[model samples]
Target: MFTRRGFVKLLGGGFFGAMALGGYAFGVEPLARLSVARYVLTPSRWPSGLKLRIVALADIHACEPWMSTRRITSICERANALGGDVTVLLGDYAAGMNLVTRYVHSNEWSKALATLKAPLGVHAIMGNHDWWEDRTAQKNGGGETFGHRALAEAGIEVYSNRAVRLEKDGSGFWLAGLEDQLALLPGRKWKRASMGGLDDLDGTLAQVTDEAPVILLAHEPDIFPKVPPRVALTLSGHTHGGQVRFAGHSPVVPSRFGDRYAYGHIVEYDRNLIVSGGLGCSIAPIRFGVPPEIVVVDIG
Candidate 1:
């Protein structure tokens, strides 16, 4: 029922809309937008008097133009201003993708991250990219990766299948960090069998001698199903909110559960999990709908 002129106009409009969307996704959102995704929660077991403000930064994926040392420093400065009792670095410090003008060296990015300050101190964990990119670690098959050493050298405490007890205002809690769920790369030189991971949830949780509310720092949210109720909260980042979210849905999540744990606060059966959209891109240098975020969690 449409005329030839109307058909041509519709085609032209669609073309321009597509161009605009592409420009925003590739040029603007990824490079310019920064947001603070804040969440305040009180888990059932968390002590009422013990309030903790946790400032968390995830998936640095350090690279030039997209995520430089200067940019990381700026992000840290903003995080410090938030005045958190503790700060946790949810991994992926290595360059997530090959698309980069210049890859930001590990030392450089770690030095920049050293500026971040919190009362309880800064804690970090390894992400899949951190393990996959470390050729020496991959080749060695077992040992401290360059990312771990870099973070340690920077004075940040890097935990892998480790748990530490922290006290705030005479109240204590456990901060447990797990090794990456995708620690081993199968296609690489060292091929034992299938894709195995270094993550040890049982071992990590076993170290929690006391019943203080445990806050688990895991790089990927895929391990959420196995997490027991002993953990009051689990923090993760690795999906990058699919790196192109729309209408609260991510078309392609790196997680086995798809959009279930892609981003934001999720609770199932009284178990709480918060997956940050994170500060860098992965696989591709583009972001839309879900902007880079510095997650602030105030919980008790």
Candidate 2:
């Protein structure tokens, strides 16, 4: 029942539709939603009367065309207003590749974060890009500083393969963080790809005691499977919600575990995993289906 003219029209329409979708995914949608996804974590060990508000920012690639230092400062101000007990940054503060070159100084970004208000304190960890990008090379002429010093200088305690205790209303739990998992790149020696050095889960976990509850921060979500169930929760970022979602499914997830560990919260066996979509883009400046986000998780 179709005529030649009708078929041509159909093809033309389909082409335009594809173009429109691409525009939405790459340009329009990426900027449209600074979505906030919230979750409630009820750990049995956590007393009911007390609650912890955690504001997590991930993959904040602080450079031009995407996120500048000014933009990051705005994000920090917004996070401060949220009135969280703790603030955590999951890394990737600077872009690894050239989307734009006028990269914001890491130290400046940290100073902006210094103004963030959290009674429990603001903590950070590095992503693979932070190491491989060589942001710390200029300081020690390429020794392993990672980007920890910048954040730390801004008063944000940057932890790698270490544990620290956070007290809330006289009850405290051990909060731990790990170095990036795929830390060692193919041609590197004695270093993680971040080149800030290595990831030592065993070393970090050994510092924690069995009596207190533990929440571990590991940047890459794929490491969740390796985390012990005894740890109450593992918070991570790096997937960027697969960076683009179509029909509610994202095809670009970079995890070794596929989309299974891609984004948001997941539970396998008795262990829990929380993977954030994070806040910025990596290589491509355009995002189609996925909108940038800041995750606010409540734990009690």
Candidate 3:
């Protein structure tokens, strides 16, 4: 059943198909396409007359080769143009994941992000990459600081297992950033370890009562199930909108919950969760149906 001509044709056809698919993934898919995923959520405890517009930026892995300073600046400009009462950045601001080629310093990118302006202001939280910096702090020293330092320089408050009351015109809600639990898992070897994991979910929620509308900033959506009922909303990244999807279905997702919490808005236990399709690429720099986007949520 095998012939020399038949085998050659089969091989040639397979090669062409592979090239075409790879070309699309590497060339056409990575272009920055912005879209606004809007959601209207009214928390039972939301203060009357207090309208909050929330913008979430996640997984902006501003690596040197992939994400340059000028590009990061442009990203901030686009985010600012959208206009939100408060802007939040979910972590992984480092240059790259898995292997590093050209490293993008956090401070420089944070300065670019500082340009993002809003009346309520901008906030951020650390991802696993930030925690990796802490793991290598002894060798890298201050240079390893990723998430908090840069954002702080840009007048953005970095939330780590803490709660802050953001007030606007005498009305506001409690916005909190939970620590990266994955980064701090104990007994984890080789670049993935934490001295003391301080997620402190209970302590973080202690400041907010049952009657307060709480918006949570978490890098991973795995925390969704653990979140108490007080938190009306959870904004997260690190999913990268699955980065690759076929027919709106992603075969591989970096979540313990699988497709249950992969991307987009998920309403579970009466809590609304929004996971963004981030600005930059990670692991392997290829994306399919899932394009990079900025999410704007309006809630009153």
Identify the candidate with maximal lDDT.
1
Cα lDDT of candidate 3 equals: 0.77
Candidate 1 or 2, higher TM-score?
1
Off-target runs (Cα >4 Å) in candidate 3 are: 1-14, 98-101, 137-144, 185-197
Steric clash count of candidate 2: 6
- Segments of candidate 1 deviating more than 4 angstroms: 188-190
Instruction: Estimate candidate 1's alpha-carbon lDDT, on a 0 to 1 scale.
Output: 0.94
Collision count for each candidate, in order: 0, 6, 1
Q: Model-by-model lDDT, in order?
A: 0.94, 0.77, 0.77
Q: Give the candidate number with the greatest TM-score.
A: 1
Q: Model 1, range 131-239, lDDT digits (tens) per residue?
A: 9998888887768898999999999999999999999999999999999989888866676576668999999999999889999999999999999999999999999
Query: Is 1 or 3 the stronger prediction by TM-score?
Result: 1
Q: What's the TM-score of each model vs. the native?
A: 0.98, 0.90, 0.86
Per-residue accuracy of model 2 over 1-300 as CA lDDT, tens digit each: 999999999999999999998887766665445777788988655666667888989988877757767777777888888878998888787675586757777786677667777888888888787776673443333334547777777778888888998788877888898877654444344433442346787899999865678888888887777788778888999888888777767787887678788887898887788888887888786776667888888887
